[model samples]
Target: MTFSDDLIKLKQNRSAQEPLPSGIAPYTCSAFFKSREYGMKPKARRWDHLLSKESHNLKPSPLKTASRASGQKKLISLGTARPAPEYFPWESLSLRCLQDTVTEQAQPAPTVSMASVKLEQPYDLGVAMNYGFSGGSPQALRFVTEHIEIIHKPPYDDWECSLTCGTTSAIEIAFRIFCNPGDTILTENYPYSGAMTCAHAQSLHILGIEMDDLGLHPDDLDHKLRTWDYTKGPKPSVLYMVPTGQNPTSTTQNLIRRKQIYAIAERHDLYILEDDPYYFLQLGKSKQALASAQLDRTDANEEFFKCLSPSYLSLDVSGRVLRMDTTSKILAPGLRCGWVTGSSQVIQKLVSYYEIGVLCPSGPSQVMLYKLLDETWGHDGLFNWLRSLSLQYRCRRDNLLESCERFLPSDFCEWNIPAEGMFLWIKVNISGYRQTHTASHGDGNVARYLAVEDRIYQKAHDNGVLVSKGSWFIADVQTLKGVNFRLTFAAAPVGELDEALQRFARALETEVR
Candidate 1:
């Protein structure tokens, strides 16, 4: 079929029940920076005006004096250091404070000395005291490789890994190295907001393929490539996908889907950017224990594990696939440490981005994480910790699900129970609520007026809950429907989840009442 023919058929085959887009107007230009499209209406888009007003609150401080003040002989202008805000934890506590706390807490007075920059005795403490390899300390990479071997295997011993600041920096580097400006990248219609934003900033053409529960519909993917207008422009240079615990949507692509998607990428010679931050966050019971030692060198071997599925990195034969793994969710977000494993070419490119961009992520953060992992948890221990975490999050997900089911109006809110990841993407039926309204106001009923006003994000925030609005993810602002929002169960404590849900329900009730 022709490209146009395929596009028509795909649109027709989309779930007929899908609601029409209802949020703001289509974006006039890319919002790598803000735009005026949402500001056309004076009152309808007052939020846009408020945002503008807030942007001007910061002024750049004058540059610091190059030379020291001479003997107070009329000390000239040296930029004043503002007293650090209470919120600034870094200013309040120094590294020395942490050392003192550690020292005081030790029962036997810990042998490790906090006084010196370098430790003289035992256990190669130098790694902790010193800077590591550019790609990260060798031990971190080895541990990651070992983890990958146990989980998602690299193919043919051909793949290599590099440490990135985080997935964001890795993706930015990937975009820069593999594809040029105006290159086309295939992604889900509602892709990761960060990826979409990055691609936009780089002037890459994002070809958003429609997604289903499984992920990018394989048929749609094939159709796009097979039916593209090569005559008019270039074929897609890269295909970006978040197969496991996708952001915003929280959908996990099954192996059946991966094989098909991989096939399409291979057929089209398209680079596959498998940007999965929550790869290890798969929310299900632990799988049958296959000895970690028994696993092959490549993480590729465990691709089809029944309970916890492996990644696209495992399925890749050609070096086209670039897999991003992060410690943010599993460890702590503050660490800002993650790794990218792919072809040597890809790793080299990302290394260059690291060299020029931030040089490397925090040296101490890496050291601390590395030491914590090596000392406390070896490979097996780390795996077990992740499994325990997965279990905890699973319980959290169940709680969030239960809360929504109990509190939300049955037909009013629609969402998919995510198999893996934190978010539950929900859509509210604004029009349905409009049909029934008793007029309390002189002019019109409150419910009728409220139906026209979307509360996907605002209502929740006002009620002491917050979620990412769907409009933030959609590229075409005109196509955005304000009805949807991505709610997370990750941050909130389990005890508070029900209360948060109650707040969310009350927020919605205000409109109906």
Candidate 2:
């Protein structure tokens, strides 16, 4: 099995109580043990720490158990933040009796409010359902909110967070909040298909932005916004992008480019929806390992983390960035739990809509993840898991990368070293793609690019190779002239990847000239 295979097994079976029937511990010698130790890297000596490489949150997030219990009391208390709606008559009467009993005993009986009592109950779905707006449990909000502050180091305390299924829901909510039907959503040239699906479902238009190695090209973004014909439709107010380890392309936007994009957004009045699910899966550790030949594993981890590109949130001074993080990438997708951080204005509207539809994330998912991420691992432990996860994917990434070059026809296909994310984007060069085929699709002599692509894709599928056609992600089919495919390098077994490539190569050879 490849590192990717092993990694999946470890994550899926993480809930297992006993050793696997194989008697091996999950992730034995997983990258965590083999790679560097934990902690962020040292920054250059500087007066203003803002620009320094050191983590803005140099210290670990304090465990909010005790602190938040006290705070939750005040928030839900009388004359505090909006008090939770009064309990139903029967529920309040029962609570009153319990308090009366305590008063008779002359003891400060645990204040038996419906909301506070729910948290004190043992973690149970039924208990979770008893209170909480459709939004989520207050504890969940408290946890993820503090977590966002720790990682992204948002400068404003006014920002609020809401739990959702994942980035998909976050994007949809943002769409509902900031845009109406027919409004356009701008994203990278090859955007995440799922988001596109959601946009199409709402009768919204998707505007594709050109991207480069660093990520969304500032010049292209500026040009697209400045020249966009508003008479044709509403000006795109949202720039939705997966800046870190972007799907399909596996691109990470460097700090400079992120700031550039943010600046352009300011000029254009765009809300940057940073849908970065793979933020923690930092693949640059592989490069760090090679570069730090003299450093130990811990040192390598520090350097790897230090060198990671700063997020858009870090550069977002005006709270213009609505950032979402998921346990799906770091934990399990089936959990379907993630959080969104944005300005109070955006969050209020998002939460208002969220209440009417999928009220909040699943209770069981929140319960399990809360236990795993917080109760069990805490901050340092979670970081360790992320580092190790990156290493395992790195192993898989290298294997498929080498296999692509070896199996594909060198004359037509081109591959680049992808630092992060699951898929490797392969550009396929074909004759007549631009001139004859695109200009006139029906002519027999002119190559039908889509037809040829369908043949190759069908051939691969028939031969047991599932691959994604790059055209599916293109925003402008008319302008895109080349053929390409997005192959997963961080999934499936290594052996399967080799066989899949062999099958893919055969399909290419048989179908394409």
Candidate 3:
């Protein structure tokens, strides 16, 4: 059936008591319904009159009117109600604006220092690195595909793949091909920021699924599918998740959980974007060891084996899964090399985006990664290096957690012992305080957790410590309901981690106290 017809059927089915889903309200119109009924746009004047009549007839119930009479007040106009400019800090804004104005002009200036250096790889000589293949360099595509095969263990014959600059681009391309603006999409409650940004930019409707410790709850997903606006027909066409080491929550599901999640997707006939960057960074060590070694990076703890977990892509069937993997954490983030593995049709669509867009992923970056892979950890050596890397991170995670334990009050912050990846998602407990003073976030707005990014950055520069705020990974999403932080222990030295954690603990304590 046509979308218009489906929308009418959906509206006719909707109860008056139910509020329209936030993103689905734009398409509801009598003309839209008529367009569906007759397969054409209705006369604008006729539709407008009908809409006007409907709007005029709608009225607040007597109880609602009476309640308003008792206590309701008109919304204060922003122009009149807002505090004067002098009442707020104007200097900070002026200084920041001046800095931005200065920085913008400073970038275009020609530097004399440029003349001192000879090009190791000249850009003007019709460089071999001008661009790679339309999809990506043959070597890069091969490297990415091979990496997926090694990491996900999907049947090499069953899966087709392509290289994108990063997971965000891959997702954006896939989104363009699969959904138009206003198309309904499903995602985990706390999703990766990149995916949401791409979806929002495309004007897609985002439906977030509730999450538990096991990740997206299967029951909640199943319920959403069964009870969704079927009159509109199929509320969501896609499901996106980062099942392992989720960005803001750091929750990972086990094989059983994966099976349930996949089952829900299959039952609902929804496509899955299994974005798993932290898949390899999971620590499989024991909890006791995790607690004791929270600040250590050396593989000293024997208990680390218990923390290892599998990924969602490993369990995918029905060809519905689009696996996006990246080399940012294990290798350098500067490479910006990531790949998508899925059906051949999907890969072709992604390739179309690559061809028309910037052509493909960087050639030098791809080759650099390939060389780093071969030289540092040839073939399956990549796996070995990853294992060693995970072991190293496990100790760092233990240290961060231990530091939290030592420094903060027991009730001040809550965090999961990270199994994989560089970040520890921390939720600050603000029960005792009237106002939580979080200075780490980019903005000092009390509406969200202070990201603590600047504070961590300054600490890294001044005291030799580094960490990331949880706010960076938060998409402009309603599902991220509370204050949380994402801390990275990957870069900081082992000795410095203890000091850093201590500093972090002090910071958190100071915020509340």
Candidate 4:
């Protein structure tokens, strides 16, 4: 049959079949399932000019191309060397998961399983355990795609999703795609340490933009971009940030701030790498409000989504935002599974990178996630779980906040109540320490401040408390001015939070005295 004839027949078959229930699509890549019913939103503006020299040199893998051809109906694949599924040791896998709803009493967790014999199922171990496409197994990709649509629906058309190993890997891949060695990149003054290390390894220059409690300062970002210095390197074309509950700082950008930053990106023609792992941990404006509010299971999902700060992807009209999300924080970190959403062209490039690099995310992880998210907890169930999870985190945050209030000396330390995420950023009054322990040389003032920070950190450790020094997270050492520390309320038991803070307070008291 001619290609047009095949297309017509396929359309006829689709029309003849019963339609899927609302919001449900057949197992396929998100690109194939994107809704076009919104009356022709404009396609993402072309970003080919932003590609790095290395990305431009990447070509499609010959083996992957051949594998695509092998998918044709009734085609015999004598050329490929893939092992048969029978050789796989595993027959079936089962997982025990807590019920989506919170309960006053303990109950037996539900079990979900996937078996090789379940060929009739949309996804099973047989297909998932073997070699697969670089983007990911269709089942997992579909789930993330649908989740993204329901949550942050990008404003532009032709956006796509691709499964990733995790956000860390995604960051590295992004850097490779858009930046060359020695290229400058912009990020918050206090950025995630891991990301800083990743950029450093690539020999990329990082310019730290000043920030406040609301997160990255839009004025600082715009001023830095406006006053570009080519002698340092090509003007940065990328901005990396953690918009929601930013790491080390625990600052969540409000809607107005997000809009201002997006405007700056548009003005400067820069791509935004929104690394938002803490996006779902939004705890609201006040702890008391979160504590008092009762969750209505019927409308909890709607309420939860409404409370969230809009993502940069939602504001993206030109598809310059590449948002990375991971299952690490929301789920288990060891799963090492996540996904990136961006323009179709950008996603295609990431997929190509996957084919030549990791090949694909772990098959077992993808299949297990598929069974958990797609089979066990449907979209509503997952949202219900997320709501419950947020409440649990809020309780933990409250415990830590209460502890801080009771233990930390008001005269020496202060902090802003974190609106989201697992951390509390505390600013220490270091004026006394600096005055008493002045640097021998005038130029050593910053060095002297760092020494005092180290002294305080050591005192805290000796007093049996652990806290992260803010200096370790500084994107630019030259920007370091004050003494700060990060403390996490996510891992400790509620009862112990107070004791930990008390120890930290005692240590601070001794050091300042």
Candidate 5:
């Protein structure tokens, strides 16, 4: 305890410790910026060593600026933030182009527009060939923004919209914007595997919340956040879920449940990445004809329309929710056009991301889409298209369910009839099968379950029927409470649905036994 003894102990510790590498020097009190003599310019000697042997003759790329004596200036922008002139309000240009395309059959067509700002048919074609230049066109942005406001009705000032290549890019942008590596994100019991890939690829930790037939369980979500084991990591700051026509499950969250989940996110200061591509494909009531028995058909439709579950974006007041929508469902998947609506802060980042990623949707696709939806179909026409699509899907869903009932035995399988979306999610539990809930599904015997699921898939394929294994859509199949499979009523021919079900039944019998 004496001063001499303490000095001796410190000397002994310093002698026992390892020394730094041969060439490395310790950083003590170094001045990064210090004024030297002669005009107090940067200290030349300190940075002179960094100048390459290229002899300091390297000059930056020269901008093609007109001579200073010239009256007109030709300033060109080569920055990444170049103005997206192609995205300007081009419906008027599109209509003119369409009309001219027909009118100028005999006239010599000018492949290039002589004018700088005004675009013609040739311009449209050129843009289509290489669209998404400098980001989305202005008109494309307008249509995306207008659709969400008139359709979904997010708060005007609190939210903004941007056109993305598709839902995948939109989600990837959101992940990068909202989450950092090692951050926790709350996901549903069964998440869209694509979104899960984006999350895990970013090295984010995912916590799966319990879900019911109606989708994410708010009570369980609240409990998970409130009594979180921080020792695992930090509290989840983002919630990734699908409110309508949940993937693989084909379930939609009712309005009350959506409200509950929103409240929990608010309480936990969580940002919601609401991915709802099936919002327009709601199917239940369309199965039973409009109640035209009592009310007029129009009135009956209004009632059914009102019955569709409200969106989580409708309940988010904190501007914490960002929604991803795609035309892939209602329109065409190859168009690669989708949009996100959320707080300005995140949307701005997403736009920047798009500029670096795919730039924007194809120019022709955006223009043609805007013309088709806004100029030709209009909102009313879109609604009509959706109704027709829904009716078709509903019939397919009903037929598949009936076929399943007739084909698969109850003891081996069960599924709730989904009121919304394209697929029928059937729980495939062979009789006497009771799975034990052990560790996190990630560490469980997922490989074994995957092998089992793959056998069923291979069998179904061999029988000329294709079913998506539920494991593909879930975070971890081993911890799944039940064996499940997703059969799409959307893609198969209507007459073939029943036959497909028969084939699925055969495959299940072979594997489940």
Candidate 6:
């Protein structure tokens, strides 16, 4: 049997030995089932000095602290105002989930259910409806932990995982924990706009490092850190990136590039916030063919695992990487479920924030995920589903690329084929417009460029094709130097994608001319 089979077996053995007596299992970490037999790995170095002033002052919620005692065996006397499971209105829950396969034809999805009966299901409405610990319910936590271990096995011994409401919430918690007001943070030239706003709300300064086709340039990052001026407050201690299928740019960092960036982070003592929502959506060159080949093999799960790009977490020997993962891309976004994997100390700090804030992810979401991820689809099943999903997205990406080639004017627009993720970044050549329009208008080059971008965006909107302005994703709007638009292939039908591109092409022609 393969390594994945061994892991599933380990999980099953553990589950059999520790059945939930009263529907609630004790809060646990990855370490519970994580094999320590692997040759001696160094422990993660302490990061106390890197924490924010706010994080330093944060105290655990008293009620949350006391809730832990309720998990003890045969200890029934509860001091906290805990609700009886009998009072929860939900008697049972069920889900109709797709079968784990990569065939071309549609297959019948199976129904998986969880009832209040502990014997019927290990996780059910009883534990799900209750106010649980900030770390999340043990069943869901274990599945994610094992998932992380099987996939990106962090090199350090102290790595742990905790559930989050979603990647957006995880970003907020991470920023709060690591950044202070007036502190500087480094990010890719173009980042997820929501993250920039999150940082700005806390009065943090963001510096955008130059990037190439492969993603953030390591030399640019090193140069920025080495030349950081103290007059602008402290040097940036955190470096945020989307690493795989990077937002707006749709660039995936190769292993060599990732190692180069990690070395720079090590040299600068920087903490890397890896917000990789599109990690699983990594569609390699000719992904549909690759998926077919893998599914044909008996070791499809192991082969699929081998094909994935290595995560920053896998390279984090010092535990400087806080990797945030989400179900928003792989699963339905409405689930509002995600997870963070980092050093134990960092994870504990995040849990403290959760206790005072959201308390925990929606218990219903957690239980549903537990049922789906842990009960219905095990680790192997999830890998199969992801492989199938990646193929579907790849086909969508192909449709968009084909549309761009067939409709868009070559002289005015150029785009790199996205290797992964949902977006296609188009670079509009506005030099002709700049020469003809900006020179005549007497407006500064930046203003003229932005004006052109606005006109193109409005034209596209009027033509019934909505595209994201590239300028909106820039970390520093003052430094915007290009007229680019981000188009997504994730939404819209195959036929509509072509129509949308045709409309966008017309808009570009009308505006740029």
Across 1-513, the per-residue lDDT of candidate 2 in tens digits comes to 232333344444344423311100011111111112112322211212111122222222232111223313233323222223233222221121121111124334333233323334443333443323444554455456545544665654356677788889888767666666777889898889988988898878888888877677999989988898979787787889999888878888878788889899878778788998888776553434433322225444454456556788767767788888888887778989898876655565565565466755775566556555555555444555676667667667777867777899888888777776777887777763334223345644223666667777888999998999987987766656667788886568776878889899998887664
- lDDT tens digits, residue span 1-513, model 4: 232333344344435543321111112356654444333788898878889998999987877776663334456667656777667788888877667655455354667767865344445666777777888876787678767876787888788899999999999999989999999989999999888988999999999999998999999999999999889889999999999999989998999999999999999999999999999886766878676556664556767777888899999999999999999988888989999999988988898898899988888899778777877876777777778788888888888889899989889799998888889999988776746654455465577768778888999999888999999999987778988999999887778898999999988888875
Give the per-residue Cα lDDT of candidate 1 at 441. 41
Q: Which regions in candidate 6 have their CA more than 4 angstroms from the true location? A: 1-25, 70-72, 102-105, 117-122, 286-296, 434-443
Report backbone clashes per prediction: 11, 4, 33, 0, 5, 0
lDDT string for model 1 (233-264, tens) is: 67776888888887778878888999988888
| Weakest ten-residue segment in model 6 by summed lDDT | 17-26
Worst 10 residues of 4 by lDDT: 18-27
The count of residue-pair clashes in candidate 3 stands at 33
Q: Best-fitting candidate, measured by lDDT?
A: 6
| TM-score winner between candidates 3 and 4 | 4
**Native-referenced Cα lDDT, model 1:** 0.60
For model 6, residues 119-140, the per-residue Cα lDDT tens digits are 2555567777777778878888
As a whole number from 0 to 100, the lDDT of residue 451 in candidate 1 is 36
Q: What is the C-alpha lDDT of each candidate?
A: 0.60, 0.63, 0.56, 0.82, 0.63, 0.84
Q: Over the stretch 321-419, how does candidate 5's per-residue lDDT look in tens digits?
A: 888899998778998888787765556556555555575577667766766665565544455566656666676777887788898867778888777
Clashing pairs in 4: none
Clashing pairs in 6: none
For residue 337, model 1's alpha carbon misses the true position, in angstroms, by 0.4
The weakest ten consecutive residues by lDDT in model 1 span 22-31
TM-score, structure 3 vs. true = 0.64
Decide which is better by TM-score, 1 or 5: 5
Q: Output the number of the TM-score-best candidate.
A: 6
Clashing pairs in 2: 36-297, 36-298, 37-297, 37-298
